[model samples]
Target: MNTMTKRLTAVALATTLAVSLAGCSHWSKRDRNTAIGAGVGAVGGHVLTNGSGVGTLGGAAVGGIIGHQVSK
Candidate 1:
């Protein structure tokens, strides 16, 4: 990736992490699990798909659903 792309990707991941963690304060266990899953999924997707936005979002959605279901 070029320098600009790298910087943008870094900013996006940081923003995603911050938003996920920051919004989870006082959340229920299920919510926390979902957030954690999404975070992990995003990172995994980025790695597996070479930083694709679609892959990242898809992974987050799938992971969040799995996390929510597993918590029940």
Candidate 2:
């Protein structure tokens, strides 16, 4: 995909994740943190890797793990 498309996709994904998480009133703080971390990581990965899919997924995974552990 072109650079613009990739950037837009990343932004959309992040926004969707954030908005969806915001509506989950029953989630604990850790749950929220994980979602937030995944979103941020995805964006960061996309930027760092120039929109590589593998990079994005890896970032999300690492971020989720960190977020999950942060509350401990």
Report clash pairs, candidate 2: none
Tens-digit per-residue lDDT, 1-72, candidate 2: 688887798889878987898798798999988888888888888877888899999999988888888988
lDDT of 1 by residue, 26-54 (tens): 99889888887777677667656777899
Residue 68, model 2: Cα distance from true site in angstroms: 0.9
TM-score of each: 0.69, 0.81
Note the Cα lDDT for every prediction shown: 0.77, 0.86
Once fitted onto the true fold, the runs of candidate 1 whose alpha carbons sit more than 4 angstroms away are: 2-23
Q: Lowest summed lDDT over 10 consecutive residues: which window, candidate 2?
A: 1-10
Misplaced by over 4 Å in model 2 are: 1-3
Best by TM-score: 2
The alpha-carbon lDDT assigned to residue 31 of candidate 1 equals: 86
Question: What are the root-mean-square deviations of the candidates from the true structure over C-alphas?
Answer: 3.1, 1.6
Candidate 2 lDDT (Cα, 0 to 1): 0.86
